[model samples]
Target: MDCQGQTIEVTEGQSCRDVLSQAASGKTLKKSVACTCGNRLVDLSAPVPRDCSRLEPVLADSEQGLEVLRHSAAHIMAEAVKTLFPRAKVTIGPAIDNGFYYDFDFERSFTPHDLEAIEKQMAESIAADKPFQRKIMSRDEARKFFSQQNETYKLELLDELDEDEVSLYTHNGFTDLCRGPHVPSTGFIQAFKLTSVAGAYWRGDENRPMLQRIYGTAFADRKALKSYLAHLEEAKKRDHRRLGPQLDLFSFSDEVGPGMPIFHPNGALVRTILEDFETKEHLRRGYQLVRGPQLLRRDLWEKSGHYQNYGHNMYFSEIDEQVYGLKPMNCVAHMLIYKSALRSYRDLPIRYFELGTVHRHEKSGVLHGLLRVRQFTQDDAHIICRPEQLQDEITGIITFVQDVMNIFGFAFELELSTRPEKSIGSDQDWDRATTALHQALDSMGLPYAINAGDGAFYGPKIDVKLKDALDRTWQCATIQCDFTLPHRFDLSYIGSDGEKHRPVMVHRTILGAIERFMGVLIEHYAGALPTWLSPVQAILVTVTEAQNDFARQCASELHQAGIRVQTDLRNEKLGFKVREAQLAKIPYILVIGDREVQDRGVNVRFRNKEQAGTKSLSEAIEMINEDCQEPFKRGGMRYSFSN
Candidate 1:
């Protein structure tokens, strides 16, 4: 077959390395980590097949090669663990997005010291440069081999395999059951570090025995690994769980039940500001604000196919012998509202928006502060439009998401999710809905990845993942197209032909969940929110008791100008008050002193400790008001104290 416009033929016994070496005509192969024969990735040592059409090298720094390197590092880690604890049973070890993890069942939990010792052993093994050997054996032989060693987890895994033969990889004395195309030797692991250890139930089942999962990361070289570790350090500093309480944002209480956060006064103020912004924006976009009940009849959920597709993640109760479920989504209520009235062709596109609170039964292990909670508020909206107007409606939602994300200073990527296995819609319906979403994305020249079989049960969706300051992606916004919901709810509108036609439904959220979005926002800005979003935009501090009255007057004027201002008239030092205001991340500190009272102006200090000099009361108010404008209307201008 042709490769790089060259015709090359190879015999069966020749390895990929030999073939590539011949094809290269004496060029070095040090940069090549692996080779792909057709669609399958294989090690350089693997024999070339006669049927191979084209062969290409996988570079060490490429995405696929990084995965291979990480997987190999995981095996090396397992070997090191086995060396330290012979009785430890290794389960599955897979490469994840930024790293890799290996689960092991030991008599006791592994400690920080154990991790260090394991790392030492891994380094030693890598220095030895032991080759990884792969072997295939009959299922019975593999079972007997693992059973003899009393590796019960491996034995159990072997029992579940339907294949008559299985593959095993061995490095020096350690062996593991895996289907792999790992690096040639342990020495290939040039840079790696074990990050942490956590408890995970076997196969994620709580009833099963708990296993100690060790997480680690590997990169092509030391520089990349060092950069990643630095980023991780920054991420820890920006952790919302710690910053939330430090900044008096939100809290969780044992008595209040897990996964339910109690937003303190400051937190509530931020929430209210965000909700108010959402309301004004929605109204400006021609959306009507609406509210729905917290719970609905179980039959309604069943009819919507949620009971069958998402019941495991739902909470249910029996009321008056009729079962009911807490709303895990806002679609049902919006659909009910749409069905409550008939619509004419002129009203084909009716948008309803809600800051709706929803509850879902999340496992205790997965509940992370506000990021993953049982009860949270969602900026939910549903738009019902004619089939002919589906594409335009979807396009409008995409534009809306871009505008909102820009206001938050977030960069986002989009993904199109197709129908899942348990989805209820007809193939034709799914196809049409998926086409409309694609058309919208394509029309805007937006590039999106496809997440196959991961859509909501009733519809296809576009997931918008926002990137924060730490460069981590959070799934915040979504636009879903549902043909089945209207059909299930029997929702329709009169067409120009005077005939009733089923109106298509589009489910969307600009900020998907208020709790989660706030958490991301807190971490994104490191608790120093923009002036417009800050709970207290400014604080008034009087230099002396003599200036207290003037400080209060200044605060009142600022408040009247729509700034969230508060005055500190306590008998505290001016420096102390400034420090406190800065600690609270207040955007501006207005200092009123004898000189300022005489001049009828105030000295302004920003949260970043930059002084804005003295400004007359009216000038200060005007500058503050300009900074307080919502970011969307301000053309995506970010917060700057200098401004």
Candidate 2:
């Protein structure tokens, strides 16, 4: 075998090194790796069979290499935990984005002290540099061994394994049931930190025993870990659940039901601003905004195939012995609308937009403040186009998504999701839709990942995930190519050749949902919404009773100038008023006192800023007007909205 310029030959059953040594004049150097067997990376010194591909080692710095390292770190963490807590039952441990987590079913929840102790144990384990050794065993033997060892979880897991043989990993005499390609030694995990403790059901089923999940992050070096920890702290400070109530934006009530969010006046105002902006934008893009019922008969869902595919997530009701369901999606209703009229090929790209509200029965345990709510409004659209125009229509939707996301100064990544196992579409239909999505993404030259089998049951989809100020990504937009819904609803259009053909449907959303977007914004800006979306653009504060009229006049003038403004005529110190406005995240505060009234100017205080400045009332209005007009737009903008 020859690689690049190197020539190598292997004798039957000889290791890679023997061949390299014979190929090179005693110059071939040995390499190091995590594993090498069956796609498992290992040390370079490890023997490679004559049949081995014996490919060059991928360095730890490579993207794929880091994944291998992270997986090793997970094993180390599990080993440390088992060492610390002997009674704990280990389940599955896997690597995730930026880190890894392990689930353990223990008699008691792991407290903060337990986590700290676990961390210490992990550090010690890493320092010891114990080798991660793997051993294979037959299913019956493995089951018997685990049962004898009092590892009920392992026995339960082994029972589900149909394979004749399975693998086990051991570190420091603490062995776990795992199929591993872990790093050679614990010393390779130089930078790692345990992050959070959360409760999860065993195998993700609520009916199963609850397990304590411990999350941690690992990087190749200490610097990376430090930087990640800093980002985590910043993210905590900007958590929407914390900032939302502090800014008086929104709240969730137990009485209203879990996952149901109640927007305060200010929060509602922000949502209204988004709705107005998108509604106008949709009109400009030739999309007709439409309305649909929040709840419909179950029969409609049955025809759309949603009742069969996603009935579990749907909230069904029995009214007069007839079943009804709250709509979990808007595509079915939009398809019905398209079918209402006989469409011509000229109306191929019939785009319909709606701020459609939807409901899903998300598990109570996963009910987040607003991000994963059971009830939320989607900025949904459906485009019915000719088969020949599928690619163009999809590309148009991608462009529209980019333009809308730009409004909020969001940078996003894209993903293409293919068909799932339980999907409804035919093979030909799925292939065409998936191809169209891929072509659209490729045409746009956007970097994307393929989420295999992650699309909607009805179709393939392109999901756009926005990266916020903290670089955290949220799925904020989706463009789904659906053939099932159109067919189910019997949608058709007259083609150019004067023949009727089924119209291709593309379901899309610029902002996935109003409530979720607002939540994202709260976290992105740390609850300080830009002036354009602020409930009040500016607040006019009077220094004293003597300046009350002047403050009101300033506010009225600003309001007449098309700025959202209000006056705090209460007798209070200018500093107190400014502080109150800052607390509300108001963009600007105009302080008018006897001095300002006599001068016919106003003192200005920017939110979260200590310094104040004085500007002519007209000058302040101009400053605010520029800011409010581009609330969604970033750069060179300022506005104050609070009193």
Candidate 3:
């Protein structure tokens, strides 16, 4: 065996902890959460085989160690809750991204006060520093034990297990069923916080009993936990749900529907700008604009495999005794467009772009403000090309994503998602599609993580997730290669040999959905979008009623110059108007006081409160226009300007 370049002989049945302790000599080994034996992550207490080639330490501060710490923290939290509530039944608890949550069945709801009490109890348990011991028993023994203790949830879980044996981790006389790689002791949980509580149906089934879920996060130490808490505070302040109403950008109403959002004048302005930008950008890239109906015949969806693989998430209706489905995707319509006429190889790479709105039957419980909604418009596009053109098309889409994200000042990562369990497609087609995406990323020398079993039903895809200001990732772009759709729809083109050949389809979206992208943009920029994207770029303010005419003239000039300018000429204090403009996050505040009226110039106060010396009206307009130019055009892409 090798331990950090040092060779050592391991006897039969020697535990990883034993070998690690000997290798470290006088150094402390307790910080190691687990050791990787070959490719398998094994607990420190697990027996090491004689043939194990190498041992690598999983430090508490490492990724795997954090998962172990959070998992153990969840168990400790459950122990505290059981001690305090006594009758609360514990179910499944797992470590998730950024945190952990444990579901419990209790007689009543858990209040914020209960969370505090449970936290205090957890602290006491951590102070005791009890060692966590793992024991294996037959499924029957575990069932009998839980049954005698009246843990019906545990018995139910056990009954569903197919394995003959199971593992239980116990600490401080509290035991839970888990396949765990927990911390060595309870005290190893250096920092943790119980975040909140919510109601969740058992296993996410609405028909099942409702359970109380406690959410929490854990880190290696206090500093990491404090940093994470600070990020959470910033995220809360930037939450689009709060900022949307505060800025009067958008709103959700009971009258309209739960997941449907109504955009006000200000919000509509932003959406219109985004859509216009999408149109111009796609046109510049040689994509033709297209439109499709909101609903399509159910037979078409079944032929496209959406009915079989995506019906559960689709909304269907019976019209004129025929079943129809609200379009959840724009690909089917685009395929029909390709079939509308006989195509030749000369038009192989035909790109169709649309601002297509779609609807999905999202569970009410899962619907979020704009992030997860029922109806949203996608900046959807489809490219039909020959087999040889797949790589170049995918690369071009990746470049388009980079260019668009750059315009929005976003840093993003790419991920390749493979086939899902409930998807439809031939194995050969799936493999080919996956391989094409892999080659595209490789050709560009871009690194991407693979997301197993999470692709679109029709094909594998490359998902682009943008990192916002707070470093939170949001899914916004995708590039999918589909070989099945064209075959299913019999979309064909004439080759040089005058033979009919199936065209390869590429489905992609630069900005995934207008609503979700807006939500992300709101939070990413903290409601202070760049001048070009801001709903109101500048506000014209007068010191008093005397300068109202001058402000009006200035507003008209700015407006004629294609600027979204508003006038604030109320009989109010200058400071009051300035404060209001600042709160609205207007990029520029043009103060037209008596001096400005006399000089025919404007005093500019930036949103960040930086002052710009008075400038002539023409100068101010030119500067604002330059700042308002879209980033891509500013980067030297020629575009015709219009209001």
Candidate 4:
């Protein structure tokens, strides 16, 4: 017998089932192994392995298995929907990140009440424990069968398929055109939740009939599902849209169009502080900051493969009868800078960094406040290096990612994405790039998943995902090694051998996007930014108009000391001002009442809690400066005080 093109010896006249059993006992060490007998996927219990070569059992926790479970859950959901709403017509059901969604071409939009009812039906379907049965049929047979059942959406799907024979999955009297290896029964879906409802187009085409898409998430167990739900609740509470406004940080206007965020003065204060810190950090790391235009000629993108591979996601305009595209990436311009001058092997590992704003067309349905936006800034960098120096460059990037994320108190996991199916350049080049990434990860002693066929078309990549306080994972950084881009752009450097050779290019980002990171930070800190990063670190107030001068002086001193200070010299009473500041979550409240003003001191009040005693002018500055320098999680600013 031959499996995956390898020969295996089996006893003559042995039953196929027996042969498969033996094969399962001696399965290969590969991660995702799927066995096909005569090009047909089957379970190990099937009796076709005797005549089959290349038969092996797939790993249970492989990506393939997870997809199978998600897809199966979608089918179970559809079956439940049909059981509940007999008139609903199922269109499409597919697996997405950690979940599955099924769309139906129904007459009315599904309401929250409908979702609750559908969820109840789904629970009952799981309890019924119906089997997921697969059937094979010719294309004509499938089209005729679905047509007779008034499943126009299924008929449309069948028409689009190019295969001679189609596979159909059935569960509890409901059938769908599918190529699947589902869980044996509905009982396997122990945990699931109906998330939301939205309108979507058939086949994602605007011209097609609109469908009501029901989003949902499922997990292997009830505990896992509950954990996910809890994370979702936390995410909503941390949502920057709600917190940003309540905290008086940012706003969006209909006049400015959707997806473009406007930072208020307070928001700018926070962003300015972050940018200043990052600028200093980048300079210290030997990076030269550069700026580029917001839009460039489309021809440049063509050379960089952005036009070919990602043009559809870019915003384009016609100027002077020529196409100009808003920058979707910062790399091409950096490449042009490197090529502007002649270089030798001596200038081998040149690194250029940019906090560049880029524009990409994200679907409106997918856009959420700051997380998914059409325009955002990236903390991007490009490293041009020699092949021999690739590993060290990658190591440096890993360290950079670690340092930056550690500042936010996040622990991250890494994954290496290998070559994708729709890739450019030669196989040898891809192999080398992939090997270098694997070697880097191995040398760092970091455990990571090898995500096969998930890399960019140009090369392999290492993705960093951070776990939040709620145990939710968010991808925050990526390091990509590209050999094809150099070849495509004819980027070259003089070798030590005095000949031109393509330099290996590494694209790395510490923070994937600033807006998304800010959103994450809002949730991570629960809208209470640290003293060093807060929009308004302190609020100063006077007991009456008599002490307004003292309050103004206090605010000015803190501002000069690089602390964001706001003075509440409003005509309101001191208690009212203190209450307002506390409600705004300000870290510090300095009150200059008549007693403290006469004594040349200020009363200190902490937000969300009772007050500390008064301090002199010099004393207050010294304390605030110390607390701002090294903030902590103790609610109020951390200070170094002597007894």
* Top model number, TM-score: 3
Model 4 misplaced regions, further than 4 Å: 1-73, 83-86, 94-99, 123-139, 160-173, 177-192, 205-207, 218-227, 492-502, 541-549, 569-583, 591-620, 631-643
Cα lDDT of model 3 by residue, 504-609, tens digit: 8999999999999999999999999888888898899898899988888888988888888999989889999999999899999999888999999999889889
> What would you estimate as the lDDT of candidate 2?
0.81
Worst 10 residues of 2 by lDDT: 26-35
Query: Model 2: number of clashes?
Result: 16
Model 3 regions lying over 4 Å from their true place: 7-15, 25-28, 47-53, 638-643
Cα lDDT listed for each candidate: 0.89, 0.81, 0.90, 0.80
Q: Model 4 clash pairs?
A: 2-53, 2-54, 3-54, 4-54
Candidate 1, 1-643: lDDT as tens digits: 5554567787768888877876654433665667888899988788876788898777668898998889989999999999999989999999899889999999998999999999999999999999888899999999999998888999989999999999999996899999888888888888999999988888887778889999999998899999999999888888999989988989999999999999998899889888887887788889999899998999999999889989999999999999999999998998888888778989879999999999998877678999999999999999999888999999988888888888888999999999988889799999999999999999999999999999988999999999998889999999999999899889988888999889899999999999999999999998999888888888989988999888888877887777888889989988999999998899989899999999999998899999999999898887777776656464543332211
Across 1-643, the per-residue lDDT of candidate 2 in tens digits comes to 5522465654565544444455443322322234344455544434665445544544454565567677777777777787888888888888788888888988898998988999898889889988877788899888888887788988988889889999887877777787766666777788888899999988888899889999988876688789999999998989899988888889988798889999998889888878877787788779998888988899999998889999999999999999999999998788878878888989778889999999998887787788999999999999988888889888888888877777688999988888889989799999988988888788878889999999999899989999999888899899999877788888898888999899888888889888888989999988888888888778988877888777777777887787878788776766787788888888888887778887899987888785458889998887877766674444332333433
Q: Cα deviation in Å at residue 437, candidate 2?
A: 3.3
Question: Clash number for every model?
Answer: 0, 16, 0, 4
Which of the two, 1 or 2, has more lDDT?
1
Q: Could you tell which candidate, 1 or 4, scores higher by TM-score?
A: 1
Which candidate wins on lDDT? Answer: 3
TM-score of each: 0.94, 0.90, 0.95, 0.80
Ranking by TM-score: 3, 1, 2, 4
